[model samples]
Target: MSYFHKLIEIGKENAFVYEYMAVMDSENRKYYLERALELSRNTKIRPKDYKRCSYIAFQSFAWREYDIALEYANFAYDAKPTNDIINLLGCIYHHNEDYDKALSLFHEVNANYEGLNPYVLCNISSCYKKKNSNKMAIRYLEKALDVDKNNKLVYYSIGLIHAATGNKKLAIENFEKSLEIDNNYEEARNALNSIKE
Candidate 1:
């Protein structure tokens, strides 16, 4: 098949996988994402498409395959150092408990896309929290909240930072706020209960 034809096939597979993902059908999402990866990996196709590699990495992450996700994320980052790919690398590092690496990537991403993405700020906040930098974590979490006041992730992170700083009341307040936005947020619930206990 021609390169254009191969690209078309990859695009179709990505569309199908994304559609399934939108509906939270993890099994179907994985099936179509795997198909997408196979199509993208065909000998006739170029392997330099960072977007496809990023999608594959995301699929691996969704399936909890952290190592594979990290590999693909690194590939995507090397191919194109866009904010999205960089953020994915940061997430992979964070998931693997490589907080220092994750923190560096998050800072790089923040410098490139600062004030433009609450999610990136949230990721930075998480890395700071993991590193036991409670003040810095709170700073970034607040920045995330300023970007998106209704972001439950920011609230949760703020709760964690406050808890780590031994501010149980503030932690409970932020966790409650997180639960208000997402009642099923088990992390917030667990943190709140732990602090209470």
Candidate 2:
């Protein structure tokens, strides 16, 4: 860590240096990452390095810096609106509580791609859940089930929606399914206990 600090002192203007330092400094990850992003603007930065931009954006999102994530996500999106980038942007918007915008981007990925992606379906379901559209949320979760029946997350999400809607029986069923897939899933176990209580 001290080596990284010394490197930063010598190469204070290097975005990559700060970026790497961020990865090693969990306690100050957000600070170093934001500094790297700020310095990136002044540097050449590889003429639209979508991969790098995406990493910074994802890290920002992980740290709950939605605005910063959105900024870098847009940079990647402008370069090439791939499905992954679109999904990341949707996730950022979702975290920012812009459900409508998040839904639009998630739907765009569904429209442009063939076959169902469980992750995208789950994200769409999450946005719908946020909008209080429990029925729509269940519908997408069902689609996710079709994509991967063994996906414990899908069953867990279904359990959540059912629990919210006061369908205790269905909630128990789905939560059981989730636990059956992964008995160590603490969330499923906790949710199941809560429902039982």
The best candidate by lDDT is 2
Q: Which RMSD does model 1 reach against the true structure? A: 6.6
Across 20-98, the per-residue lDDT of candidate 1 in tens digits comes to: 4423655565554555445444523234657767776787888786765776676677677788878888998998899
Q: 113, model 1: CA deviation in Å? A: 2.0
Q: What's the true lDDT of residue 124 in model 2?
A: 94
Q: Which residue segments of model 1 deviate by more than 4 Å?
A: 1-48, 183-186
Model 2 lDDT per residue over 1-197, tens place = 68778877787547777777877888887788788778766655443677888887788788787877888788777666789889999988898899999999999997776547888999999999999999999999999999899999999999999999999999999999999999999999999999899
RMSD of each predicted structure: 6.6, 2.5
